[model samples]
Target: MTRRTRRTRPSPTALPGRTVPVAGSIAAQSPHHCRTSPFSSRLSYDSESMRCRKGRTPRTLILPLAPTGPMIRRMPPLLTIHFLPTTVESARLAGTVAVMIDVLRASTTVTHALAAGCDSIRPCRDVVEARQLAARPPACPDNLGPLLAGERGGTRIDGFDLGNSPSHFTTTAVGGRTIIFTTTNGTSALEHCRPADMVLVAAFCNIRAVADTLVQRNQPVHLVCAGTDGEITAEDCLCAGAIGLELQDHGGFDTHSHDATRIAISRYQQLAHDSDQLLAELRDSHGGRNLQKLGFDDDIAFACRHDTIDLVPAFDTHSSTIRTLS
Candidate 1:
C-alpha cells in the first residue's frame, strides 16, 4: 500500500524540542532557545550554538521566527471513569458521551430487553415511580402498555410483572412491550447522567459493541459505574476497564484519563488473561455476592461473559427511553 503525504506549515509557537516535518526529512526544533536553517535537514542544534553534523557548506534558509508569547494549549480528549455516580460532577458531563455500567444485572438486562424486541425501556428511580410510569397512558399512539420490572434487596418487588434478570427479558415475555424499570443503582445512575450529550448502557455482554461505538463517536467519554448500594463494586469497574482496554486499541488513554480509570484498568488486567478467573472475580464481587445469596448465579454468569451481545443501547434523556443506537 502506498502512503499518501500531506504538507503542513510549521507553527512558530510549536512546543519546544518537538519534531516537525522540514524539507524532505524530520527535524527537531526548539521554539525558544535554538534556531536552525530551514533548507538543510542535516543541521543539529544545542543550547549554545547550531552546527552542521557533516562537512557541508553553511547556507542561509529563511524560516519564520519563533513567537515569544504565552502559548495556549488545547485540552486533550479524556476517557474518565467514575467509580460511583456521586463521584462525577454533572457539569463535566455536558459534552461527554457517558457509559453507564451495572454489569451484574441492570445494564445486561436492558441490553437483552432491546435485543429481545422490547419496544423501549423507561428507567425510573424507584419502585413507586416505575409503577406510576407503567400506569400512565402511552405517550405515542402506537406505543404498547409498559410493563413493570425492577428489584429491591436483590429480589423482585411484589406486584411487578418482571424482575431485573437478563433471562426475564426474553422475547416471549418483553417482546412488543415497553418496560418501566427501576433499580437500586442502575436507573438512578442513568438519571444522574442526564446532562451528558449522550448516555450509553454497557455491560460485559455488549462491551465490544460499546467500545466500538465510543471509538466511532471519538468524543470525550465518562464511564460511570452504578455501584452497589452507594459503595463501589468490582464488577462494574471491571466492565468499565474492559471497555477502556478495547478503546486503547483505537485512541488509547491520554493524560486526562482519570485515576479511577487507572484502577479499573489494573483490576481488569488481573483477570484479562483467563475467562474462568474473570467469571470467578465477578462471582466474588460485592454485587456478585449479593446476587449469589439470592441464587441468581445464572444471571451473574450471563453478565460475566464478554462480547456475547452485539447491540449497543443508548439512553435518551428527552424521551426517557433506552433504545438501540442507530
Candidate 2:
C-alpha cells in the first residue's frame, strides 16, 4: 500500500520575443533569424525572432549524432590485363607498371638470354635494325660488340648468330655479350609498352619472378600480350592469364575483371591443373602451331614450362635495352 508521487512534465516557458525550449524539445528559429555556429555545421544559434523570407515560420531540424567507428577505405584495383599489346592505350600506361608477355619465343628467349649471363638485350624493330646496332663500334675497348640475334618467319635470319629459340642462348654462347635482338612479335610488343612507367618482360619460365616483383612493387599493372601477326593468340592470352592467376594466388592485388582479363583467367583455369594439358593447349595455339610448323616444337615446349627461370627482365626505354631487374 505504498503511495508514489506523480511526476509532471515541465511546461514550456517563453521569454520576450523568444521561443523557449520545452521538455525534450528545442526552440525552432527561422534560418534567416539564426546564425550558424563556427564550431560545427550542425549547430546554429538564434539571432532575432524574424519570419522566413517566404513569410513562413521556422521548423525544427533534429541534428543527427555524428557517425562513429572505423572508416571504410576502398582500395583501387592493382592489376589490369590487356589481351593484346595494341589494346594498351598510352593514357592508361602513364603511371602503371607494364608486363609484356610473349611466351612463344621473344619473351622466353630474352629471359633465357639474361639467365645465361648476357649483359643486356636490345630489342630492335626489325632484322636490319638489329644487324645495324650489332655492327656499331663498341663505346669502350672492354665492351663486347653486340651479337646480332633475330628471327624472320620463325627461322634464324641469315648471318645472325642466334634464332629466337631459348636453347640457342646458352651460358657458353651468350655470356657477357650484349645482344641486339629482333623478332616478329615480342620486340614490337616491348616497344609498344615503352611508354609505361616501368616495363617488365614475363614468360611462363619467369612467371613467379615477375609476379613476386609485381607484388613487391604493389602498383597497378597492365599485362600486355604480344599477339601473333595482327590477331590475338591463345598462347599470349594464356600467358597473361597465368600471370593474373599468380597475382591472385599471392593475395594482395585487386585484379580487374574486364572481359579480356576474365577470358584469360577462364582459359588459364581450364588448363592450370595438368602440365601436359597446359602444354597441349599452347601447342594448339596459333603462335604455337606456327612455331611447330617451323620446326620450333622445342621452343613451344620450352616456352610452356613454368617458373624455370627466376629472373625478371626490365626494358629500358631510354636505351631500348632489356636487362635483368636489379
Candidate 3:
C-alpha cells in the first residue's frame, strides 16, 4: 500500500504499553474478523494472546465529539474512535453503544461460540469467578456443562474446559452450553463496558454484522480496542479503524476525527485492500508471534477471515450473558 499520511509517534502517555470494552443492535445479523502499525508493518498487531506479556504502560486518547476545528462540518458525528487505556475506569465509555474489539481470540471466540449455538456467554474476570459461574450452567434442557474457558500466558488455565482459541469453540463442544469466559485482555474489556447502554463484541469474522447494526442504530459509537496485556496493541487499533471506516461509509459518521481515531483510520486505509497480507504481516506483532509459538497460527488465520458468520453477541448488563443481538 502506498503511504499517504505521515505516521505520528505515540504520545508520552501512549508509549508502548500492554492491554484491552462494548452493544445493542438493529436486530440484524451477519458474519465476520485485529492489529498492526500505524506506519511500520513491523510493529503491527496480529494476535490476541499478549495478556501475560510484561512491562508496558497503559494509555488512552479520545477524539472528543465537540467540534474544535473548521475542518469539521456541522456537528461532529456521534462516533468517537477512542484509543483507550486497558482499564475499567475510563469515563469516556458512557454511551448507548460500545463495540468491543479483541480480534486475536476473545471476541472472536465469543462470536464463534455463540454462532455455534452456545446458549450464552458470561465473561468473567478471573478463573475463580468463571469456575463459580460454571457450577451453575444456566439449567439447560440438554444438561450440557457450562464451559470454563480462558488462558493465562497463552496456555489454557488448569481445570478449565477450554482455552481462548476460536477453534476450540466448535459446535459439538460449545453448542447448547453456556461459556464463562475469562481472558487476559478481552474479558476485562467486556467488564469495562458494563456501564454502557449497549455492548457488542466485534472481530474480523463478524465485522459486517456489527457494522450493519451500527449503521442502523443512530446512537453514539464507541470503538473499544481491547489492547494486549493492558498495553496498546496494533491489531486492536486496526480493528477499531476498520470499524470506524465502515461506520463512516455506511452509517454516515462524519470524517472529522482526532489523534488515535485518525491513526486508526489511516492504518485501516493502508491495510483494507489486502486483509490476508495484513493479517499475515501483523502476525509478526508480539501477540501474533507469541501465539504462533503456542501453535495457534491456524487460529490467527481463522480469526482473520472477514464475514464468515452472522451473529452479533451483545452483552446484556442485566443478564450477564452475551447472546446474538437479535
lDDT on C-alpha atoms for all candidate structures: 0.72, 0.70, 0.66
lDDT per residue, candidate 3, 151-255, as tens digits?
988889999899988866766677778788889888888878877778999986667568767756657778888877766777777777777776655535654
- Candidate 3, superposed: residue stretches over 4 Å from native: 1-76, 87-89
Q: Candidate 1: RMSD over Cα atoms?
A: 18.8
Task: Write the residue-wise lDDT of candidate 1 on 1-326 in tens digits.
Answer: 12112111112222111211222111112222112222123223322211112222322223334477665443435889999999988777999899999987999899878766677888988887777777784663346567889999988899998898886676668777788888889999998899999999998767767876786676789999999999999999988888877665444335235788878877776676655667788889999999999998777766765544457789999888998786
Best by lDDT: 1
**What is the full ranking by lDDT, best candidate first?**
1, 2, 3
TM-score of 1: 0.75
Off by over 4 Å in 2: 1-74, 137-142
Strongest candidate by TM-score: 2
